[model samples]
Target: MSKYTTIAIFGLIAISAILYTYFFYFKIEERLPIYQPSQINPALVDPSLIAEKDHRISDFNLYNQLGDTVSLSDLEGKILIVDFFFTRCATICPILTSNLKLIHDRLPDGVHILSHSVTPVADSVSVLAAYAEKYHADPSKWWFLTGSKDEVYRLARTSYFACLDEGDGGYQDFIHTENVVLVDPSGRLRGFYDGTKEKEISQLYLDLATLKKELSKIN
Candidate 1:
């Protein structure tokens, strides 16, 4: 081939390679959707908190297992996973905690997990401390939280939409569910998983990794 012809052929080969990389190797990941109050099952959300769109987790002031106060602001700029359970739960709670432990082990720094006690009347700070210890949870990375029964249940049903039970968090009220909710650094609800199922937990890990990649592109 002539010199100009050889140069033209090389340019075409380089252009083809770049296009192939962009189309096949460099994929733009689809981010998890930001869940809105209306998108959630109507029964799971408190009637007062439901909005047309762009519903974010409400602020909360609750105590972790160490009796230290924790709030939504404390978790600002951090990815979070949240779940609701009681220390006394004997059925699926244990499985959920174990699966969460797996995520906690693999999660990147600045990622945190919050577990709220549904039966806070019985699960005092001491009880929560023991539960956290039992799970070998890292206090800084994973928090076992306890608060007023009413406040906890209100957050569960209104802010997180984590349970389907209906009640006022009164004396006879109790909430139970297997959901593990994923929240972004901006406090948006991104996804939900069945905490008791291994397959769901695996999917959560994959989604978490995708979230990490998404955040990296922005930063």
Candidate 2:
């Protein structure tokens, strides 16, 4: 082969290598098989049997970072990632939220992030606003939310399947899991993820992409 032909062949091989790296190996973590109703330890997911029966939590009043009450109904048709966190947290919250931002930045305009403050008493609207600004959260696409402590706790347990305990609002004040719950446009619980786990976080983002593709089939 001539030198020119060899170079052209090399260029094609290089392009293929780049695509492979971006898609299969380095870009997103490999997704593990999530426990579906058909293949789960029935006891843990039993209550969730009503999962398909129960509609997504659609209507509720919560304060946005701006101190204004906002309703989930206001965001009905968006692909939402709901996560529970606190401003005062010295550990997982920051890391989890940072990873969440990674997920948020990758999504298209129609997708959104709904972050709920676990320590609602301490993380008032103003405080949440500060946190949002500190993280440079996009107000249009991301909402830092707060509401009644009891209601927040209830939502954490029933909605995200996260933990929320009662206390004096200090260390061990709130009990909640570290997972990003993905919800569909019609408000179905699609996937739950370990928000702070780097591998899982990446997989969750890609799963959102897959979820969107599945959603498109219905339309």
Best by TM-score: 1
**Residue range 1-219, candidate 2, lDDT tens digits:** 999999999999999999998887666543333333434323324354434555455467888987777887788778888888889898999999999888767767578899988878788888998999988888888999888876676666555554432343344556656878777777766787888898988888788878777667667
Worst 10 residues of 1 by lDDT: 45-54
lDDT scores in order? 0.89, 0.74
Per-residue error (Å), model 2, residue 143: 0.8
Model 1: residues with Cα > 4 Å off, grouped in runs: 1-27, 47-50
Q: Residue by residue across 64-84, what tens digits does model 1's lDDT show? A: 999999889988789999999
